[model samples]
Target: MRVVIGEDSVLLREGLVRLLNTSGFEVLAALGDAETTLTAVEEHQPDLVVIDVRMPPSFTDEGLRAALVIRRQWPSIAVLVLSQYVEEQFASELLSGNTRGVGYLLKDRVADVGEFLAALRRVAEGGTALDPEVVAQILVRRRSAPLDRLTPREQEVLALMAEGRSNSAIAGALFITDSAVGKHVNNIFAKLGLPPADNDHRRVLAVLQYLNERPK
Candidate 1:
């Protein structure tokens, strides 16, 4: 797989390039800021882009803006943003289009090499891989009307789903059987009016709905 790295820190950039290369990914470019990342993408057309949340110039959200632009300009390429903070709003904005090929993982989570590589592969194949911490932060915020309708347990299940957990994983996390987790998932889906037909991105759709993305 061809990959691009967008990180301001030289050490982290080199580390990512080395890791990806060791894992058999061709590192087309290890860029410093969003501008160079964008330029590299245009020049290399890599299969996956691993970018940090902050970058040169403002160092606030330039990398995120570049990811958004990449999503708009070239939806085929996958984007996985590694951030130091949870930053739910920025993560939501990246997945705003409601399709796939996007991911947002916390920097600390990178220590788990197995999970990190799995998430990278998942996003590359057009799957959402939001960190569980990201989902928890989103639910930790203020509660709204529609969200108020869901029971606390259902809310917990929904949050796990938003984190890209499978039924078995949720079951393991919640200390329940897979059947029980499946039931909770179905109930949450039904209550949220999310069709079971499109199961792949249902978690993302459920999250977008919970955030009240629809026109008010």
Candidate 2:
């Protein structure tokens, strides 16, 4: 897939591009900052974008802010955000719009080339992908109210669901049958007030909404 790289650190940016290239993905552009990344996206229209959580000028959340703009401007372009740390607020913002093509993986995950590539592919295919760490953080921070209404098993299902795991995948991970997983998922949805008909993105939106509303 054609992909763009955005990171303030030149070394990490080049490293990511080289790794992606070695993994058989085309690097359309490797940019040093969010502004350049945005410009490259407009010009190249890459199939996917790999961006750092923090980028130039502010050395803060420029890449994330840029991702939001890109999502609004070019809803079809898939985005994968990599960060050294977890940012529940940013993840909530990214999926808040209920868009289908987005990923938020921790930078440490890059050590597993296969999983990283898989996440990239999933996002490009119009699926949500969030780091398991981020999910855990969100659960810990918002352990009352909406999330508290869930049973432990239901909470496990919701956590996997937030990590973008499908029914079969979650079942395999939890050592349960797909039907059992589906039942748990339905229960979680009912508790979360997420419509049974909602897809991955909408599920993400509902969960994010719940997390965002929790006391900080």
Candidate 3:
């Protein structure tokens, strides 16, 4: 997969290039700021963009906003956002609709090569990858009676789903196999009274339902 990287930290930027290259992904360009990253992405049109949630000029949500822009402008390109912290609101915004090829993961997740590569591949293949932390944060504030029926582990899986994570990413985060994660997802939907569609889109639907019930 060809990729464009966006991050302000020099070490992390170089490290990501090296890591993705070593893993057989082509690094089209490694940019230090979101502005250049956007330009590079538009010019090169890489298969995927791995960006930090926060980037230069503000160190806040510039990268996140840039990602939103990319999603709007280039809906076909995949995006994977890495952050030190997982904000529920940000996750919601990123996964606001049925947008595919999107990811929101914590920075620490980079240390797990298997997981990170899996996420990259998933996004590249037009799937979603989300950090378990983001999922936990969303679930913490939601008040769903059906969610109460799940076991803690199952709940964790459900939260990961809300964050747009795939079965493989959830398995990697939870230290389980993808098959086990699939079972957990099935149980979650069954407990929540959702149909057995087995589509990741259903996960987003479930999240939106929970978000709608919360007192925003």
Q: Which candidate is the best by lDDT?
A: 3
Ranking by lDDT: 3, 1, 2
Per-residue lDDT of candidate 2, residues 1-216 (tens digit): 899989888788888888889887999999999999999999999989989888889788888888887887888999989888876555665765665888888887678777878888899889988888877876654443377787999888777876778889999999999999988877776566443221245567655854665457
Q: Each candidate: what lDDT?
A: 0.80, 0.80, 0.81
TM-score of 3: 0.65
TM-score for every candidate vs. truth? Answer: 0.65, 0.64, 0.65
Q: Please give the lDDT score for candidate 2.
A: 0.80
Q: Cα lDDT for residue 72, model 1? A: 77
Give the per-residue lDDT digits (tens) of candidate 1, residues 75-139.
89999999999765556556546458889988987888878888899989889898898777665
Which stretches of candidate 1 lie above 4 Å from their native place? 142-216
lDDT at 186 for candidate 3?
78
Clash totals, every prediction: 0, 0, 0
Give per-residue lDDT, candidate 2, residue 190: 57
